[model samples]
Target: TFRVVGHFNTGKALVKATCGRTFNSESDAQTFLDACASAGHVVSSIETKPSTKKPAAPFTTSTLQQEASRKLSFSVSRTMGVAQRLYEAGRITYMRTDSTNLSDVALKAAEKEISKTFGAAYAFTRTYASKSKGAQEAHEAIRPTDLSASSIDASREEQRLYDLIYKRTLASQMADAKLDKTVAKISVSGRDEEFVARGEVITFEGFLKLYLEGTDDEDGQDETTKDMLPAMTEGQPMTRQTVVATQRFSKHPPRYTEASLVKRLEELGIGRPSTYASTIDVMQKRGYVVKEDRDGTPRDYRVLTLSGTAVQAETATENAGQERGKLFPTDIGLVVNDFLLEHFQNILDYNFTADVEGEFDVIARGQLDWRAMLKRFYAPFKETVDTTMEHAERASGERILGVHPESGAQILCRIGRYGPMAQIGGPDDEEKQYASLLPGQSIETLTLEEALDLFKLPRTLGEMEGKKVTAAIGRFGPYVRYDGKFVSLKADEGDDPYTVTLERAVELIKAKIEADAKALIKVFEEDETVRVLNGRYGPYIKAGKLNAKIPKEEKPDDLTWERVQELIEEAKNRPKRGRRKKS
Candidate 1:
């Protein structure tokens, strides 16, 4: 069995010993700690405090591309090129944003465009506003910098992005996207499954013309969104297409990529507009991550990172009796959570976290004293920590490893209720204790021999080969009653058979409709006026069954244009009095 990599917990002192390197400067460590303190302040402390300032700047090209790619799967290059064309053609304002606020001139242009394009009813009294407190209001919002200019013919890529951004921007400047949402609750095998559909009716396509997925900025709204369902009234029953029953195992914390990392940074309030890209670059350069090429028909590469904070937390716990500044969790994060909830349930109260946040908010607003707030929080938290340490049983630091022998590959085992057990691995011998992996596993782990063998088989016979019989499983013929009224026409049989080519089909249908018979066939044809010919009844007009007939002596040519015109005029000038009574 091949061993890939194994993990063990160790402290900073043990880490230095493992590397045979001495700690030279304690002050350097202090400097690093000071930087982390500053980061913490910016993240948890400052961001928690409310700001009354203007919003941040509008989205820059990179940020816009990143967001679009993250949310919509738009490529960065495609996003930039399309945004460029929109700006040049006067469809959208400048694509670049380092400033969050719109200028007076830009605001006026947007307002005028809104009024002119949508009308005053749809236009706003005030330009749309955003609530971002630190927004740079110098640059204009992502509006069409020039409203008077007309749109131009765009390049292929430009056309797509231009249409999307333009629609988003316009929607942003307009009203909320109105949608009627419906959810159908279905019962399957005694389980409640909900199928949802959303009928999104653009009541007003607002700034959505410029951007779609984001906090509703450029407008003063605090509404968040949920994936909506199609419109339907309550009590309306729906037929389910299929019941898909699937089993899912629990999952570990997901590894973050560049896009996900940026999302996390936003959520953490650790980084902002200009710093996101650089922070990703920094993490990559710091040896915390490694980028690998993805294997496929066309190969692409992406970065993968190991959490340094997680590693540090693992190491800190190894130094049993030493003061580790602040307590951290790593391999034991979930275990600690389970233990706290199972035993010390009251200490980690659900409402405790929210209350602590409330106290911080009060402090920031000068409604509560900061020192008192910290004192109240620390007393309980410190007591809980001490109790947990005194009462909780110790965890044995175990080095975990598992391997499958058949393919000589590493197995990703988990620390289960039993010891480290194989969760995934290569195929193994059934008799041995090795993990028995199934066939047709992932393509990435497939050997070259296996791949070549797949292509070696004849997937289909050559054109010259004899007829190959195959099972006819599903319904194969046109819908017909089984009462034997319809004739069975196979490849070898024929009855009322006609070639179904496009030309022949059209001609047949046309002939059927134009026949001197039923009117049903004429329903789809262009001519709405119907024609009729009679013998004994002569030529009778059937308009609403109020019939008239031409005399037998009168020829069709006798109805001249002059007489028709005179009759039309006479009808128009007729008196509105009651019809003359038949005498």
Candidate 2:
């Protein structure tokens, strides 16, 4: 049964309570009441009038930060700290809010005061109204609760907050902060760049009276605001104002502080007014977040920078055909992302995420079938999960390439630029040069040391003896070798660099093969692709090559040339096997 507390002009109660039951009309409600009455039930009604209690002044420093901190799990101290600065420094309206409203009387008083303070033309013709919806109707917007409020004297920390709120409230009520906004959009080459400036000319001092007072309260005012700007009109063109062309790279993910987190949560629609504080608290406790400090010392810092997004910020932008950086995903996040991207790709779809959220809203209002909706979503999502897991082994093998932020290069080097590559020395073959050589087609002739020494290579090799097609070889023997080819170790490093013999060419090839082998060995460790086999030559019998025989026995044991030969024979004896099943 439902009861009505207040009635409307159409004879419908303005306030009604339905006691967990549905009512289609007044008649239906009447029938239920009649039934109850027949069964010995009694009903009564009461009338009350609304009262007019002045709401508290607009949010004050502590109050605003407290509410924001609680909703955002921001520390109380952090709330006041930022708010006080915003208030006294004039970055925002007063930080604290306690006043209930901006009195019509106060509004008129402000207008009169502004007209007297500045020229009458500078005063606003109409009152400023804050129609921001869903705000507590009785409470005032976060503004100066009192226009006549004076600058606060600093005695306690709380005074700082009071000063910020007071000045902002007065500032808001006095006038619109005048700004000489300048914007320039220029095209260079094929790209376009925009520059903007928010400057002021001949600032109306009336609003700034409160600003100045507040500035004194928070901290000393800076020189920028002390002088009035030169006057200028909207259409008038100004001088360059010192034009500058600066180079900048794409920015990384911004570090999140309490203030920024609140902003982001508001943007995502993930939390409501009452739940923000709890969310922040939980995040801190979970070890998923920490406050980053400016000087390595924690000085009332409250910003939270997610360790993962740090990587994502890199490789976000680049020139064409570049490998981007990988956003370091947490183990769990990586698994979830991969699974969602593969099996339930639709779940990753923006439309699907939105539709599901919308359905929840409908369910809350009983406008949609809850179980039916659940089933509809569960079926496809479940199928996708199953399919993903079934093929997880194969899917995990795929690699993704992205731009590297630091070098802006396609290849990623694990070690620093000075790290070695596997190679044989050619021109500058020093002792430390052994580790830097690697086998790959080069754009220029460079030794392993030279390549590693220089972080990057020129597009083409400039002036080097190795670049000449025919070079004379003397001392060791007469030989002619191509300029771009790797210098053969056997090549006579003498007067005649061009002339080379067949013996020298063979020696060079052998040296090249050895160098490549050493490099490959470094890449594969014992834990990775390493296996020991018996030597047919038997323990370095001489500085000569020897062939190892295949062994018998399919079972694993101590490796020997005889055993390897026997195992090879056994394998040949067995029937051929088919491929193993995938996944």
Q: For candidate 2, lDDT tens digit of each residue in 208-271? A: 5445321111133443353322333333322221111111233345445555465445444444
Distance (Å) between predicted and true CA of 230, model 1? 9.1
lDDT of 1 by residue, 1-583 (tens): 1101111122111100010111234333233323322221100001011112111224444446555665455544446556767777777767654343456675566567767876755444344444332333345556445544434466766655655444434444454334333223321222122222222233344443334554312223332243323333344333322111111123344444445555444444343344556555554454333333232232222111122322121111121122111112223344445666765676466455435544555676689988887786689778878987888775422222334344544444223343222333333534323221112222224343333332222122112123321111112331111111221223343311222233332333344435535432211122234223343545532223233344457553354444433443554576657968999
Off-target runs (Cα >4 Å) in candidate 1 are 1-63, 71-99, 115-122, 125-138, 142-144, 148-167, 184-211, 214-242, 251-257, 282-583
Please give the distance, in angstroms, between residue 529's alpha carbon in candidate 2 and its true position after superposition: 51
Predictions in order: lDDT: 0.39, 0.38
For every model shown, what is its TM-score relative to the native structure? 0.32, 0.32
Model 2, residue 474: displacement in angstroms?
Answer: 63
